[model samples]
Target: MNWSGWSIDRVLILFVSLAYLVIGIQVTMFHYRQNFTHKAMWIPVISSPIFLIAGLILTWYNAPWVHTMFMAFMWFGALAGLIGFYFHFRGVGIRVGGWAMRNFLIGPPVALPLMFSALSVLGLIAIYWKVR
Candidate 1:
């Protein structure tokens, strides 16, 4: 673990952190437009940045506690995304012409949450994987 204490994992984690920032802003804006009708809507808005900060912190500080906490949060985020997918999917089903293409397109995006989960998974991989 030389090269100024950076490796492929660190770089991937950094990328994921920045990505969280971008997705966080987008979710914030989207949720804000809805006035955050449900309390759960606040989950991603708050946790996303935490993920980003934790990840970014990891890029600089290679501490055991940091790694431990980051691992926990990534799992949390991954689960949140799955839960969100259910919510979003249900939301679409609630709309007119339920399960139709238009509802799928016009209702809450179902993919975003899954994407969120995927990103968390990627970070988890970067955290644990051995690049050889």
Candidate 2:
């Protein structure tokens, strides 16, 4: 690829979009193992594609509508991740060991949800930050 007029924010948005794709796959597999016991498990799986597509569209056109849609999804993803963190932490507490390190290690990934939120924040920064 020729390096020409790609701004840093544009590149960062695309990178975040790709990261969503990877994380989506991982989430899907993890949920599948649990048989997707609850519908909430599908939230991140579905939203991942929304963010990825909107972000990729922004990279191509970046129309005002696209920007708004992408920004909305980013915010949704951020909130969902936060909620997921709480749920995952509760899962560990409810497990056999009851909040022990072993339960945290084996019950649910307590930090993965925070990672999801961090990625969404990165995308938001890319979209909202004014490069000077």
What TM-score fits each model? Answer: 0.94, 0.96
Best by TM-score: 2
lDDT score, residue 18, model 1?
Answer: 96
Give candidate 2 regions above 4 Å deviation: none
lDDT of 1 by residue, 1-132 (tens): 566766889999999999999999988998998899999999999999999999999989979999999999999999999999999999999998889999988889899999889999999999889856
The global C-alpha lDDT for each of the candidates, from Candidate 1 onward, is: 0.92, 0.88
RMSD over all Cα atoms, model 2:
1.0
lDDT of 1 at 89: 98
Which lDDT value does model 2 have at 10? 93
Q: Best candidate, lDDT-wise?
A: 1
| Per-residue accuracy of model 2 over 19-128 as CA lDDT, tens digit each | 99988888888878888887888998888888888888998898999888888888988999999999889988988869899898788788888888998999999989
